[model samples]
Target: MPSNDSLARASGNVKWWKNANIFQIWPASYKDSNGDGIGDIQGIISTLDYIKALGVNTIWISPMYDSPQIDMGYDISDYESVYPPYGTLDDMDQLIKGCHDRGMKLLLDLVINHTSDQHKWFQESRSSKTNPKRDWYIWRPAKYDADGNRQPPNNWMSCFSECAWTWDEHTQEYYLHLFCVEQPDLNWTNEECRREIYRSAMEFWLEKGVDGFRVDTVNMYSKPMDFPDAPIVDPLSKYQPAGTLYCNGPEMHKYLREMAAILARYDAMTVGELPLTPNTKDVLDYVSLKDPQLSMVFQFDLVDIGRGPVDMMKLTGYKLSALKAIINKWQTFIEGNDGWTTVFSENHDQGRSVSRFASDAPEHATNSAKLLAMLNTTLTGTMFIYQGQEIGMTNVPKDWPIEEYLDVGSINYMKLIKEKLEATGASEEEKAKAVHEALLNINAVGRDNARTPVQWDSSPHAGFTTGKPWMRVNDNYKKINAAAQINDPDSVLSFWKRMIGLRTKHSSLFTFGSFHLLEPENEQTFSYVKKSAEGDEKALVVLNFTDQAQEFKLPTEDGANWSLLQGTQPVEDPTSAPLKAYEGRVFVNFGARD
Candidate 1:
């Protein structure tokens, strides 16, 4: 159902990713074949059949390159080598072959924004100010305070709640690290640095036969030339939010174009993790067909709906209207401009879709999961299914203590909370209460919620690993594991299969069709219509987002011959009866539009 004009523009340039359903695998928690309490390439190769059976045609594995695991593989020390814990180069080859043999494409996670501090490039860059590789990373001389004490070059804050600049006494300078101090930001402004990245990160993987790359922190490759302090948003905090100064800097598009030119040689898929840049027009600069850069981008607006401005841990209730506006804006603007975007509700860094966007309560969990599946597949974009989302994984248990959390972000945020409470001189009882509330909020919104090991079966370790898992399996795995639902007709797993199959069977209507939101202000229901390019095929999707039944009216003008294609709950007449809690339905109209 792609428009003739759009098709003409992409003639002889059609990409396989246009219709692909990508499944993301966070390798560490996916499965373990070595019994070493960690997942590896062999474990992923073992599960290729299971992933393909879910109707996904592409698999995007998080970083498996040689790393220190400070940020769980995001901090790459060696771009050309596989981590010893994961496997050797031969194991990675088998994973690529395993995916190719199943007719599935593989995308390796690319972390070029920064590298592990232990990387050889950084090691030499920091050895001395006169080293040949000294300029490979950002380094600035220290500044003096009013008390004549040495301080960092700027007041920029790290994403992990610390000063962005780290002092290096050996070089007599401070270096930049936007994340953990163990991960240093590379100097993309250096032409030699950029050349090396293209050679090692892109060309090396393309030679390995990967289908494409998923660039992490893609928009942050460039930083402002002038070191500047961000306006103080948190008076009590010493450092300030500096993402605006670094994200989508002046030279970002130039770097992307250079990277894209190289990727074009292999005709590879390129999806970038574009954080902090939310405007659709700004996003189009990177993904628009007029001036192509990335194949698509993962915009954070939808996931960041209820997060606080300064601290993501400060949680609040999200309104359905806000969610609807974000979806409508991205879906319409991106597609309308001949740009592309990924449709996803969950990922490695987010809480489970069912727990975050829908109800995860026992009474509504299954139905709500199906409802979310319907919404994701019906939208006009490539779909990405995070691991464990297909079987309705929820957040970590509420009773879990703070010590069990493993994510650096979660741990850092909690540490900051404890320090703040102490600074206020709160009593021990008051401190305990404040800490407990913070832990509850982290349980609800932390990255560790999705980092729990996958529940393959109801075994001691949920069948994820024979040895103890690096992370704990959710306690509810006994009732919710994939093994329990693989064969059940009404299980979340089966429902996901059906939903994916429906999207595939009608790819034109689901992928390239025109989207029209229905009842935009409705608080209890989300409904939309997708019309094929020829106007002969149309699909109407209706979803109830609340815990109570809600009445909805079908559009009289769109006609009365609509037939129910699928539903989360059985319904004889969808329009006549009120929708049950968390219910969803899809109706198809095959007649030509007037």
Candidate 2:
């Protein structure tokens, strides 16, 4: 059992991020100021007022570092400089100042897990085996099989559907790349390399006045020393899923502590992206208040509810019961153990929340979006809103072909599927059917769905760029966009503003509250209560997860008079009325509880 003291300490000494409402901006799709078909820092600066009006106090911009664009800036070639397509250092400085001027802090995306092979460090590292920088990255000698053919160091698959180790002809050894071949994993075991990362990747930004970082793949900094082969998950595939071999290795904690010490000196906020964190106990080791390694972690249990273990493309129908279980597990365990986690349903890597978790049809999209907003705001953790989520963005149209997809993971997965089908000696008709199904899956769960240009207006390219856009804008932008919804009282954007304002007004109850789920077994409805640690403020959030109306009985206590704080549909008496289709409501019961 965990002690209550952790919760007490968390509530006592409040951090800035604990009460923050963060909004994520993917630069390439946000706004293209110069009409270059790519978003830039100047464009972000121009939109500060708009973001501030949404009641968000923090802005987390995705990677804008100089890169080859192979992984959309995740493969950084330079750490200290901004990508030329985005803007220059002067523009970044101005953007920082602009955010601060409007009372908003800025968080940059930190991609220290790997660097582009084009990076000077990696170039020097692969120059010669005796080079001083040779040990800066993971390198292992190739293995020989029974035959004369050479093999990679281990039978590990990359996240993008290929061998994890890439052969280097010049170095005569294979280098590790958990993602694309261009993105080489760094060696955190090297003290000098770690120090360089602290200076160039972290200290440089902090000194430049940025508030903090959204650490990419933070738990994967350490790797297993033995470099052993992973268990065969798919017999047809030559490589295997090896996340267990590298994720949360022995030195992971030491590396995080070292990074945390640097962040503490500047009082910087950090939210780590933990892809495969096993449980809440493991998450606590990184975010525990006793000796904080990170301010919070983005756990994937909620987003990964219906997805496959090794291949995310193998998705199944999402169940409300499973969602409820995940919520109960994380909310209760983290709250009890005094750990912190982020509350978000969408990001650059995920499809639109409305399309995934709720109905995205024309009739139910608005209400469903509002329902998600209410649920997210009333949760007991820091909130994060992805770009285009406020106006209820949906996934790409089903008619879109594979050519429109720009995400490396999506493209690679499609190729993998095609090859597998070919290997089965299937007929052309069967192969075509498989390809069509794969495209449908990509349309539903692909990263490109969220990477489309932000729908600013009904103009060409949604006013994101004057020139041809980097990717196609959502076709539904004509009816759903920021310009059209900014002032509409009944619009999804307005609902988000109101919900965010409500959370801001009662930060204590929503941020550090004790969460209690109501009717956890109910499949069509999700309801939960949040009570402040001081036992004063209380809020009840009820949501209809289905498209049809559902009856819900509110939890009533003596001397409690529940009043509507916000709702998707008007209800005179929530306890008695049936919840409308895709409806959501937040009710507050003021005064002491018996």
Candidate 3:
């Protein structure tokens, strides 16, 4: 019964990780080399020819392991070294031999469900409770309170909050740390802690040739095998942190089919960020090429759709029919189930899809970052591209003070919204105007807006450092850099190299196409149309998501016989073209389709 029709049944084997685009790279705000102000791995092997001139073939990065950067390198400690201010292990073996001599494909960033309580196997599993690395991590034993106090082995919590247990006091016990008590959590039902987390951190980078793994926090690595308690639903929301009693648990697909039988003896590429909720049967049990445990799975339900609540301060107006009904409900359930997905809208923990879903209005931020790179390179999947999103990066300047925030989940969610506005006894001038309007709704969903830097030009640190820049560079890097939009042929990094050269000149119209969400209750227009499952290729797209002028129609009932092919704002007479505001075109039907 598992059928969305199985994402257009494609087991015909099409790897290079199914037409990847990737990119991510937070490595200390990408590019600093030796000046010590962070960023290394020889500043991403000297920007691998500016990420192979942005046609992006895959470069994930992000963790740069051996950490103690607390939460920055996601507190790893040492999964086989390399985080001395981001370089070593022969600068990650020359960044996997300079991204396989440029035809790129590096990945890495696989944070193994946790470690780094200064990990020496969590300091000999908190040294004591019979330390033969005492159960490798996740401890327990506190729950007292029969008015005798000492209570925390249950009501979980810490997703950077106040309590996902912690105690220890010399192994009297209470460990678990669902994020940031310097990380901890591991014990994956200890099959020798899942074979030393897949042989000391994923077979030491797939035996050094590194071409996969973005898996950090891949559904919080299996839980619920007993450690219960989280079911108070909402008794006035107190300690409400069950996240389905430990996110996507139940032996998460039997420990992702034991790391997909060691990533099927290495033809790699894994993806998996998956904070969840974009369900197509748990994303076809992790990108099913008939049970293949992940080659795709970012899906955070369109970045938690219109993020609101948490001492709110406005910023949730969505409706382009709620982002085309959550991107056509995960593009019609991963195009009928054979599943694979990742089309990302900003990453390094989001907030800069041209400033959260388009339009940073400096005359519509490079036409809304070229209509979010023509809706993530004419959708279908494997797109990613986060590092300073092409060239139109935005956000991080709505009055920068919360101590110039360096995200530990946006500084513990602005000190838990200034301790719930000083417990509503308000007025310290209304709790400093509700924490400066919740730090302008946490600077519109922050993750330091994709951790700043990588502007690469407008110098003085925008060229990403000769020193002094572990963060904070987005002073619109002299009108967005990359040496001023790398030879601007109508920039936004040349409409992301002309939508990655029309996804390599219509690669099966964005791969095995048949997605159709056109005007699915279009409120501010987002249209769609792919086709090509042998119905002789087609395209379509549209867009606009508001700024004003809207009137569109062209699902081609004779829209002057479709043609345009790529646009930001060019209607020019498709039977009375209107679109404009954040316009994005695309069209293509050389005829056929009644």
Candidate 4:
């Protein structure tokens, strides 16, 4: 629960953001009000009521800026302007105000590690060695190894695969980009670049009343002078090792401190995306509770936990012990510390939580929604809701053609899976599995799955647009959409509302309370308890991971009067209570069933 002191930071009774459960919106797929087939700010405004009804208090939008679209909107050309594909600057202003009017905060996507080649600085730097902006980008002569032939600066590889350094004919050297060839990483070594970026673009959003930022690739600011080579892992990981040197350099904290100092000046809420750092242990030092350098950090451990060889139908059954261990690893890191964790199973980059955790079948999807929500909502961390997640979106169809595919990571994995399938000695069934693996790699948790337009109604393009949508809407829009659920008491949206309301009413016990793991031995279920500073213990989170009903044995001291809070089924006595497969049980010490 929020303390009287932290809650006191409110401005004139502004105690809103503290209990806010945020949702992430990828603009391209939300809704297109102008009928141009692209979801715009106007379309989002039209759906505000739908979102507000989901018990959401904060919205985090992905990048929607002036861009070359080389890597989507991440390769930004202009910093402060809204892209025409989305809307005008006025549209964004109204969107922010619309959110605030409904008691919600909007956070912008801050992608600063690299800029589009069209950025003025990159343009000037590429012009010539004598250009004023030459130092703004890292440029160096090609190095020759004992093997012979000019190589990229160090053995550094790009995060997007291949070499991180791109040879520029004009400069007669290489420029670095941790992603695509068109996005050259900025040289943070230059003080001018840092100040101008923060003063102009970074600080501009906050000044515009934007609540906070989801800092994209913020930790890849400083790189080692000697970019070293990484030991090869996958046979297909031909990518260079830019991370060996570019990620988490010695000055990482210094730069983050500088950013924290600058953003602190404006009191902005900043969360970082650390691709290289998945475990909470990796970022524990700066992001603890007492001294949070970042408001929270997105650790992709659970998101990437299913990864390995892509066997389509094969499940990496996380025996309950391992799952508890993973959760315990994170819980203990935050045990005596102040840094909090951000919880979410699905996001723009990953497959839907329902499809990934539970079965993708509709029945399973429904259970996963309630089950996962019960688990994460009670953990000692901040909860984030991805758009359409509350309604229980599933992964893309396996039959989606190659043409429908997007996302570089999926593409890399698909190519590898296909090559393995083509190995001549494989049997027909084996070949089919290989192909299935390719589809899984492409659709398992691929971006395109989440990029599908939000299912708003049964109308054309799922009522996302009157015009042709930029991306195709799911065919199941008729059966699943916001329109049908908005007023339906039994709709998934309605259940989500209840879930959030329960959390809000019990914020003190859920938000700041320390987490304690229970029943670590059971593979089919997870149980945990949380207690706050005042010893106001009311939070008890339990989840069922399997399809069959399972018994939960709670620790002795925690055996208190309990009542069901949220679940597909109801909670009975844990000792004899058998929860249906994938069903969840959230309970409070209400002196009912125990």
Give each model's whole-structure lDDT. Answer: 0.88, 0.89, 0.77, 0.73
Candidate 3 per-residue lDDT, tens place, 441-502, comes to: 77887777778787888879787888788777878788888888789788888888888878
Q: What TM-score goes with each of the models? A: 0.97, 0.98, 0.34, 0.90
* Candidate 1 per-residue C-alpha lDDT over 266-348 given as tens digits, one digit per residue, 9 for 90 to 100: 88989999988877789889998778689999988888888898888877778898899899988777554668767999999
In candidate 3, which residue pairs clash?
A: 4-336, 6-336, 6-338, 7-335, 7-336, 7-337, 7-338
**Regarding TM-score, does 3 or 4 come out ahead?**
4
Separate clash counts for every candidate: 0, 0, 7, 18
Tell me how candidate 2 scores on lDDT. 0.89
Cα-based lDDT at residue 120, candidate 1:
99
Residue 267 of model 3, lDDT score: 87
Cα-based RMSD of candidate 1? 1.6
Residues 123-201 of candidate 2 have per-residue lDDT tens digits of 9999999999999999999899999699998999999999999999997999999999999999989999999999999
Q: How do the residues 425-490 of candidate 4 rate in per-residue lDDT, one tens digit apiece?
A: 688898887777667566766777888888888887888889887776776778878778878776
Query: Which wins on lDDT, candidate 1 or candidate 4?
Result: 1
Q: Which portions of model 4 show Cα errors greater than 4 Å?
A: 1-18, 145-148, 235-244, 278-282, 289-292, 309-317, 415-435, 552-559, 570-576, 590-594
The TM-score of candidate 4 is: 0.90
Compared with the true structure, model 3 gives a TM-score of 0.34
